[model samples]
Target: MKKIIQNFGTIVLIFLSSFLFSQNTNSSFEIKNSSFLLNGKPFTIYSGEMHYPRVPQEYWKHRLQMMKAMGLNTVATYVFWNYHEESPGKWNFSGEKDLKKFIKTAQEVGLYVIIRPGPYVCAEWEFGGYPWWLQKNKNLEIRTDNKAFLDECEKYITQLTKQIVPLQIDHGGPIIMVQAENEFGSYVEQRKEISLEQHRKYSYKIKDMLLKHGITVPLFTSDSSFYFVGGSIKGALPTANGENNVDVLKKSVDEYHGGKGPYMVAEYYPGWLDHWAEPFVKVSTEDVVKQSEIYIKNGVSFNYYMIHGGTNFAFTSGANYDKNSDIQPDLTSYDYDAPISEAGWATPKYNALRNIFQKLNNNQLPEVSKPVKVISIPEFKITKTASLFDVIEGKKSIVNNQPVTFEDLNIGSGYILYRRIFEKDEKGKLEIKGLRDYATIYINKDFVGELNRINKKYDLDIEIKKGDQLDILVENMGRINYGSEINHNLKGIISPVKINESEISRNWQMFPLPFDEFLKHNFKTKNIPENVPVIQEAEFILDETGDTFLDTRNFGKGIVFINGKNLGRYWKVGPQQTLFVPGVWLKKGKNVIQIFEQLNSNETVKTIDHPILDQLNK
Candidate 1:
């Protein structure tokens, strides 16, 4: 009798273990009748969009929790190809670029994940997230069915799939949906030459490729409501992006989906992006609340385009061209005036959003996370400086008959110096025809003047003497991110620099000053004369470390680096006066700050606790 009782008890234990295992692992997500069904029930994806690369890895969990606290059950992210694969066949996914870790963290925070792995993500990113080497092919047409482009796209997608396929909902992970190529419909219209049929073929090709590579989750295409037809794929779900216009959005989706049912707004813009020399873009909290309420009432799922717009650190920011062919480079700080600011502080938008979402769900929202402390340090003095000329020695120099663009010289992002020696004295209007962006003229290592493309100022008054050297240091600023202009955004001197309508075609020396190379080399510890571009370094000791802003009021225009990590750029041009310096990059003992100033060579900078993000110069 004892043996039988023991055997029955063992059988009961085995049954219970199997039941729990199934309960923990079993998950079902599908799109039926237009509505998303999770665990065989309707689910509304109140989602927020944030990029892992934009936000620091240390703060990923914090951002995800904030999204959850705001009643967001889902998070949407774009996987940038160039960001992951900088070189051909070379990939880096560790650190902040870790996509798998990002998704896993979202799951840990109880937020579903929607992945938009774009071979091309036009997030105001340099080259639309395309690697600089793609232009090296010379004939590879991107965003199309070009064999070479598609071949490369397939390899990237396949490699990316291997990382996140296991994280799908069916595999007990949080990823619920995958997006087809981002907003291709908008691109189709932007480039009037591309036919609608071609766009459709390209869209389907990408979708088919994703499925071919073990992506079993539902696929969706997000496009502006006006361009839905151009971007939507036949087999994938179609979604729209807009602000507050639910009626038009519903009609557009219904028309595309054959009135079947489920509706979603993939990217609801709460705030707009800011460009250099432009006013900060913002939207009222009342409007956001009203629009969100409308969507919730209509059973519509929506995601904020940027719930937290982090910094566009380094040379990652791109530019846009207006109708008049004017270049507008995006500001480095991507603070988008979002609910969560650039420094991760919550705003009135956050409170309003939390209130609306909480009431809609009839559940008590989680308490907001405590704000991170910001510290203000005394003005640090720059003790060392290295002029541009001093650092150019022994650097790779390319000799050409005429000037070449950044791509032509096989360089990605940075300033390029073009040097030409004149045989005799020549004085006239030095016209740098087809100047891509900003140029600083120097005669025999002396500052002459500056020319900018925005004002169409390509001519500089010059007086060159015999045996004198003319050096034009041209900064790429940034490449045009959108429109047809992107195809021809060749940085540096595009055409020959002429003198009084005469093309000055002569032997030229080109020096590529990519920031990575600039930081790797050691600089001489000596002060250089002001007004010329130079690298400045300063060190400060901190008793305690916290987030702070480096004031650039005294400085002109330059990039800042803290402890070898790039904070971002700051300019005297107003709008963004301070760069956010996270305490994680700071040490308690001593911290190093480096600046590559383009104009003013101020050795001192103030460190403040609060950021001056929106103060515009009159």
Candidate 2:
């Protein structure tokens, strides 16, 4: 009996030892001139760019595992400054925006992490990742040698380092390389003095800051493969932002530093984003796969722009360009036609790449998980019981001296309204100082003119003929995405009123559309307004829960929500006619549906099953 008891204790000890061995006790990657030494040998990192904030929290693990199975040695992600720290001096690193879990998950799946911690990460994101609040002070210039901007940058970097420094390669984790300001080369020449100074100072300051926070990993700054006059071209690893065909990229990279080390396609375009009226732009998946294969075959490292393009939830979606033409804002659905679509479903591109990867690696890959099933919600009715303004009435308004900008009102990323009374024959050259995107001007009840912010000038001669009130309403289409144009994202009424080109600035009433208003308003529709605004609400019951689209054909422009998870903002003037609804955000019992249509019409919302890509023209 004594012998048997001793044998049993020994067996338990053996099992415990094996468990410890299976877990990653100590792992590291070494970065030499142009190569990564993973676990002691030279390695080429085939990576893909996917942001944690963009993808849902539930899908992070599955997406990372999928990336590993696709012959990717690393997962590249952007730690968007605006995402982690929404309010200034506040920070959140969990849930869909969990930066640490995302990194650990990559390590768990046997893949390295390449972190892009940009005070200015231009992932076609709103204000290029800089928080919109910074735009409040019109005099504050970002990415410059401005003391205030640098101070804020230091604070954000210090806080972020606390979360990630420990997970880097030198610390027995998967993060091999960290990128500085993203695509800085593209903006350097344009801003010349300010750009070069900020670039140099940011590089030196951030390195010191990280080192102070105990982050000892090697760092690189991604550029446009061009040598700058005074920038830290030597300190950074030479990389191309989006140039795909290796020959063009190689020539440019080689020319930068006499052709020394490993080549990296920092951003390889997989799919383009959609605008209000444009159809879904689908890239040839075959071509992308072929190009990737070519890059690997040629011994080059490339990261897909987005391996799993996710959603831009709420007003986080950004505008692309204002190049003297159409002012195009990106749609909420960030489904970049990537390997994994926005709804966490893998596409043919994912399968094709997985199969190719298997062929190259002798079938050494993890099991592929089944795709999440699509859900459909039956028609629901949401009566618009009260307008937003009616709910918040009688409360003392936060009146401003001038028509305050969204930033001035301490508001970021949403719709804003400016209402004022103009007596008859009050004529002036109405000028808006810094209108972000689109605005609807109304004299009495008739629409006067539409201002396009991309053009950068709004001068409409107004003669208040009848009533004693003029309503100047503006919708912040979106903040600018790329270039030095980021500083111009002051939403709402930026210089609201005007008098013959001279500013009519004083005693203006600004209305901030806070998120709370969605819940505070009494939503009973018995006493509806004669002229109903575009948006309305509805209710429905469902035995089974699933994903679907709340078709907006009957209504005009607005947003829809189910169970209060903002599906996304929708505009009736489309190509993208429907908004995506995730089944998990739905209920198995009764559900509440609300719509805020832009045009004046009353119609119950009808939801139909749809994919993220197929929502165009439907």
Candidate 3:
């Protein structure tokens, strides 16, 4: 009889353990009494926004651990569509673009996930995160109820939901909320002719689309508090974005929700983004702590816009344009002066926030991870060189009467060269009506002058001899990621190349130098030309691998490729002088370094242990 009782007790214990495990994993998150309820209990979401594509895949866990250590219970990330679908019909989600792995990692680190999969994520990304191929369909208007655009968005969101649905909290995953559209309310003023009711209709369409595609989790819209009416949908919850203005934010939420409860700050800007020419933007630790305390005391949920702003690798950085059409391109490094630095190092801001959260939550914080080691490489000589002209000769040429933008050419990013022959000797005022960003004019293989869009310098005095080969190289610095001008950000010379206000209609041979294809060219080492853009190659030996910065202070504006991986662009124009080279991209022993210098070439580059991020050229 005693043996029978012992066996029954063992069985009961096993059953109870299994039941508790299942309950913990299958916890439901929902809205209850105007507050976020996790498993029927009120929960405060302390989230920090971070981009998975920006950080290396190997460091995802480290960054998430850092966020947890800083007292954040949740992570908010934006899914950049351009990063996933570079070209139409081509989808890549492996390596750095792996959103699934990122979410799973977050769950492992004990954090809930919030995804902002904006078919148009305006996180200062190129084309505002819209794939370049979308522009090919000239009739399809984006960010609206246009059938063509909606169809494409539907396909993308459908594919995305397939990956995310299984990971939602209801399905035993960590994802709690999925944002519908990003900051669409602030843009309503841009569409002056469109009524406020029309804006709400579009917002509703997106929310309905999310539901139709099997997104069971709650949908939310994030917008500035001032523009809540235009940005929010009827069914989806609305959240405000701001800093320290708790009263204004609370009032806005009450006005929208009709005095209901649970207030949330979707994007609390702890640090501001930096542009190429602008001063480095930083927020004091005291201010961040003050704002955070106010939110905590008021029982408000908030997420830092960028708790860790990583590198804008490749040509992914975006530009900004004002009402007057003034251009301000963002720097390569996204180090937004946040708690975590660009290379994932902790700063004073991190400590202050950690202290605040620990005191408020009364929970012991995790030990901070040790800083990653940085190594320095002695200067090495670049023995091999090839000119841009020689490289263009071997590429397939496209003939067009009038030049088209990069999208029309089926080229996504990098530089495009337009070559035309001047039949007769003439000196006239040459004007490129729609120069996208930057252009260099060459007459008879000689550098004549330069034109820039930032200062609106498009007119140039030129002298052309008979049969003089005219070459105008235009570099797509980056597309505007925000504001009203994003609708028409077509890179390259959009209009005809004009001389004396007359359109030059001649057979033009165009060469597309998209960086991915440009790197595959078999560059010649012997008899390289001078005074033009040249490709420089060097090999360095490393005893071990760690995160390091490639100092491009001596070199002119150009892109760096380490072992065929594009580290991103560097200019002498200040702000970002060094490019972060991840240890994963580096291997011990011999590693290849290639640079495509547009202006001046450097024989040697320093692989310094530290990054020179804020040093701007005077």
Q: Rate the local accuracy (lDDT) of all candidates.
A: 0.83, 0.70, 0.83
| Candidate 2 weakest lDDT stretch, 10 residues | 526-535
Task: lDDT for model 3, please.
Answer: 0.83
> lDDT order of candidates, best first?
3, 1, 2
Runs of candidate 3 exceeding 4 Å displacement: 1-23, 517-530
In candidate 2, what are the lDDT values of residues 80-140, reduced to their tens digit?
8888787988898867767888888777666778988877887767778888887765566
Q: Candidate 3 has what TM-score?
A: 0.94
- Which candidate should be chosen as best, given lDDT against the real structure? 3
| Candidate 3 residue-pair clash tally | 2
Residue pairs clashing, model 1: 34-262
Query: Model 1 residue 203 lDDT?
Result: 78
